[model samples]
Target: MPCIGVPCTKSLVRSNKHHLTVSFFQATQKLPSVLLAAYAELDCGGLDLLQGELPQSIANELAATAKAIAAPGKGILAADESTGTIQKRFDSIKLQNDEANRAAYRDLLFSTEGLGQFISGCILFEETLFQKNQDGVLMVDLLKKQGIIPGIKVDKGLETIPRTDDEKATMGLDGLAERCQKYYAAGARFAKWRAVLSIDPSQGKPSDRSIAEVAYGLARYAAICQQNRLVPIVEPEILTDGTHDIATCAQVTEKVLAAVFKQLSDQGVMLEGALLKPNMVTPGSECPTKAKPEEIAFYTIRSLARTVPPALPGITFLSGGQSEEEASANLNAMNKMGPHPWALTFSYGRALQASTLQAWSGNAENKAKAQAALLKRAKANSEAQLGTYAGGAGGGGAAVSLFEKHYVY
Candidate 1:
């Protein structure tokens, strides 16, 4: 049979036959054209999420999860380092990077008294999700006991985009819905997937095709997560290694975000059910121009305003090689500016962990000091999220210059 006046291919007929067995049970609701397009990508990706309609129950539940994760004056603690990545970080402190040491370090972070005061959730590595601390309590239970949501890192890592000089994209979509389901069963209510984009017009990188391809993958991943009951933190991180000025950064960020949202809409992903994990607007690392916190805030908010959907509940800025102080300052400035529709918060990995790592140094006795260091950064960021942070802590943490050209994960 022909479909829509075009001769249906053999693959199309098989897919139609399968749909006959699937569509009878689906609840149908009218969706916008944008969502239909996004669903097209999801369908092509072979995910089994609801196609015609996103159930109101699912949408409402996802909205609540997103809101809770971006709670007022609270943000996420991004401890979702892969085994090897954390090893490199551990090596910096001259500490062993074995699984036990990693567990111990994470335990110290979660065990800190009053950690939930500032952190609303934690994005955990796969191992950390299943691993227990010395006391034999599951890490997810620990986070739950503290009223902190547990989320998993769903993306495997970054891979060089084919035919691109330096642009890259996130992988691990194969069987992602299944991974999200298992993560949800393990007490994770949200998940993160990061897609990296670089700006170097001179190299003709971040080509239009690269942006579209990455955006579609992210949308597909988001759809699958929501179907499996995980609030997807849609991250399209623009790297900061180029010598580009703030204007270039703003331009690139807007373009990338615009593409991302368009794909999400087309994929039928619910905007209210997701959070954005974008790099804060700033001059590139190699740029001579230094933008103040307020300047960065202005550009960041402006870019978001132009591109992001108001339906999204929150935006948790990624540190993206920024110093802990710089990241907090930028977030503070954004909150201080006139009200935005979505919550302005943070989702930092290195920015939140650097000082704590140096202070801990894998010493048992230094645990208190390390926790204090973490609390300090957490408190600073929490206050920043409310626009009340006044620069009390002055660069007292580890000197982690965490900048890589197109970094993976």
Candidate 2:
């Protein structure tokens, strides 16, 4: 009989029981040196946990940092949009996408009065990592002065997968360890790598190939980040595209997460030293039925409870397509329901900045207004983190879902 579609090699199995072993000389004579070297490097991360462990001091620090980022009533501000993406956003408001403009915008956000009360961290793009405010203080220093942790976005961006209509795999794993070391030395203590996936039942989108690719890439990314003393925020966003229902979204999210954890364990990743940035469970953008905040909370928490281990310190949700108020409402609902194992909070991008960006519109005179707008959104998210956000945190584009079809960055 055949097993697993391969002929059962009973003779080889029986031969293995004979305890016959080849000498090093015979082994080397049969296999070339290059082949042996190739076999060894095939597994990039030598996760020999049974033989050794990462330094305890490093582990402790990573865990402490993870906890601090998800501390009570605090959430992360994801201002890490790439240059092209920022250009698109600026275009929306008829602003020039100049370097100085970007610098000023980030400066306004980081220098917001009392922002640290709500935002514990700010994820920055490569450009903002080294930029300074007009006063000449490093942005990283600015954030640190306000008790905010500075994190870097390490992934280059997404690339289309071959043979797929529109599935993407995250790039920038090459030289990641070196980049993490540089970022860490420059005062960043955490990093993010975002991998995007989409759902389209008609086209059979989000194939198993895509999920597996994401899992493998993320695991490698996490290991490299930790080796360089930075906590990794593993963001595998299941995009809210198509016309799928909430149940479909939940199912795909669960499947992706299950594969992610498995890959993490296989690579010997320290669970306590990481944070998961995932999308909240919600209906697709084109779906007719809308889910209430409570329903969204139920499915989101259930999915995490099933796939995420208790060892993880936090699960910060990404507001991919939700409006500012909608995102706050959902986060508040989740916290209300979750005396959950891991801390649940927000790491939002557009949802947190849409109103602020609209308020700024590239005007230097509007800096104070921009800062105020940003602070208001941050406070709302902070309230949501604690399950106390009241009803009104509106944005001008409340009805427009931030769901760009095949959105890059």
Candidate 3:
């Protein structure tokens, strides 16, 4: 007798020297075929000998939240930059990155007028989730008061995977279930885990190990989030840091997404309860050929259609290094070309915040101006989500390139 297939529970039982046993519950569990093959040949006996139960209500809640986050004419505001990353952003504005300053800055963004009209969700760094604003209100509560769902970024960031071509994988899985529980208790209804990959054919970049590491990590994170009653936004962002053409990017994106979905299935994650936040197909940042928004849209949708399952309710595009207007235009183009299976919106950080940060400049006197900046980008992106964006939200730093070479976090 031998064991075969993905493990459904955290516990493993060794019945004898050569036999293993895993409990099986059919009502709310799904075992993916690819994951089965990947974990095949375990020495076990009596696969379904033990009975267990997983709550179906979790699935219902996750699905509901995912849909709300993907509501039409809305997108996400990715204000989840880590403390160190926020330091760089603050430095650009000649501001300090102290806890109070950070809280105030986020308060500015979260308190913007009518943000929930276009932004359905706001992803928070752990610090922001637990911090109190100037008025002593919890930051998470600010988002909820505005009719927005709050999400927490759970991944610790990226680390280089040894024996690979400088490829990276996201860490932060240890105690993730407990952390998810805490985040849920703190008012976070959703969670995000970003996995980074880079393109460099010359260096054999995005190696097999790198792809598997990120895909598997994202799958496990998603499953854990769902188990804790939090909808997971699955983000596998391929960095725009090479000389590859749009076609090359498309090929890599398709391959990466295929592997990711396969792993998601293998982990028995409910597709209906998850959202995808991926990079749009575009020419590499250093490429000589600049792709039109239409071209980017065409390739992006084509690649997604070839791999992403229809069960997913949303596919939120990450801005990556694209400028604010470019991000909006590309999203607009995608919606113009759709009748696609999933809601194609945005989950932008720099593209959504750069101009606003510039406008604010750490001054309370500039609050109104900064908020206007935020609303403009939000409105632009919201319209883009519906293919009705007329364009031109650019001003100040909105059009500046936000790319950093081999960016971390």
Candidate 4:
């Protein structure tokens, strides 16, 4: 039997008969025309011989999770900073980065009253995902109680790709499938993997090798997460470490996104089951002229429109060293620009927590104050998601730059 547009060779058909196990009817029902054609060519006996589950169910669950996380008026809280990263944050407040202090701080954030109204999900460091609150309740349970979905950061940081101009690729793929399973069983319904790209024209930075590595790594990570029933937030973050202007950033961002989506498609990732966590187009951190939120929003949305598909559920903008107010304002500007195909929301760590952390400062007496600060930022970003934020919610830290050259995690 010959399949339309599919070269169903006798050897291929024989291999399918020997290895395929999904119910042919069910698998073919909603399959793409290409796959359906191939399946249609199968003998009745071959169809009956096929057994086991297909990715359709997993895809359904992933899509549902992605949609819920990208729901309107809600965004993600990126609390997934690694231990070393959080230590730096704690050092700024003159607080210890011990396990106890970390637990207490996260407890304060997760227990904030009505946090779910704004934050639909939170990306957790592995420790935080399994840590118990001081009250002895599981931390993930606290997030769930507040109606927030729990997600895990699965990447193990970055390593320089050989033969490249110091451009890096995210690691942690060795046991990703097993790790994702563990995370899913631990109550995480989503995962985050960040791929960093940098712009440096002098050396032809972000070489083709670097881009290919990043794209393939992200696509593979997304595939693994979806296989394990986790919606993957594909983050290809273009580092804001250059002296490039906003237009340059936009161009780089569009180029990177185009490569990313191509790899995702080539790897068979369902766009609806994935979310994009990308940097908003902006001037490099060292650039002289700081673009306003409106300008940032313009380039960001235009770049995304040109590269990102509507099938994606959302585009969660990373702070990428933007200030708290800057992040919120940029997000608001994008949404206000009206009708974009995907959700324009935030997945910010410092932008969402800088003020809150300052307010907390590891003081038990300041728990309520800190929680209020968390809620305030969450609310600001939430309103921004709907283009309703009026700004000024970032408090005194609003304009403070959170940039760290070559930031990790």
- lDDT winner: 3
TM-score list, all predictions: 0.86, 0.86, 0.87, 0.87
What would the per-residue lDDT of candidate 1 be over residues 1-409, giving only the tens digit for each residue?
4332224565433222213211111111112223534644663331225434566556657767897987888999999999888878888889888989999999999998999999999999999999999999999988888899999999988777788785677789999988888988889999999888888889876799889988999999999998888999999988898889999999999999999999998988877679999998888898988998878887887688679866677899999988788888889988876355678899999989888888889999999999999999999999999999998563654334667665666
Worst 10 residues of 1 by lDDT: 21-30
User: Which lDDT value does model 1 have at 26?
Assistant: 16
Q: After superposition, how far is residue 367 of candidate 1 from its true place, in Å?
A: 0.7
- Residues 1-409, model 4: lDDT tens digits: 5432235555434222213211222223233333324544665422112212224456557767888998899999999888899999999999988999999988998999999999999999999999999889999999999899999999999999998878899999999999999999999999999999999888897788898999999999987787778989999999999899999998888889999999988777877678999998999889898898878876776687678876677888899988898889889987876555577888999998999999888899999998888889999999999999998985677779888998887
- Residues 1-409 of candidate 2 have per-residue lDDT tens digits of 3222124455422211213221211222222223323433644322222214666557657767987998989999999999999999999889899898888888888889899999998999987998887899999998998999999999988888888886899999999989899999899999999999999988787899999999999999998888788999999999887899999999999999999999988887877778999999999988999999988887887677669876677888999868788898899988876455677899998988888898888888888888888888899899999999886765455434666776667
Instruction: State the local distance difference test value for candidate 2.
Output: 0.82
What TM-score number comes out for model 3? 0.87
Where does model 2 exceed 4 Å of error? 1-52, 394-400
Question: What lDDT is reached at residue 320 by model 2?
Answer: 84
Candidate 1 segments exceeding 4 Å error: 1-52, 398-401
* Model 3 agreement with the true structure over 1-409: per-residue lDDT tens digits: 3332335443533322223322221211232222233323433311111101235456557767888998999999999999999999999999999998899899999999799999999999999999998889999888998999999999988888998766888899999999999999999999999999988888777888999999999999998888888999999999999999999999999999999999998888877778999999999999999999878887887688679876688888999988888999999988876555678999999999999999999999999999999999999999999999988776656777888887766
Give me the displacement of residue 352 in model 2, in angstroms: 1.2
* TM-score-best of 1 and 4: 4
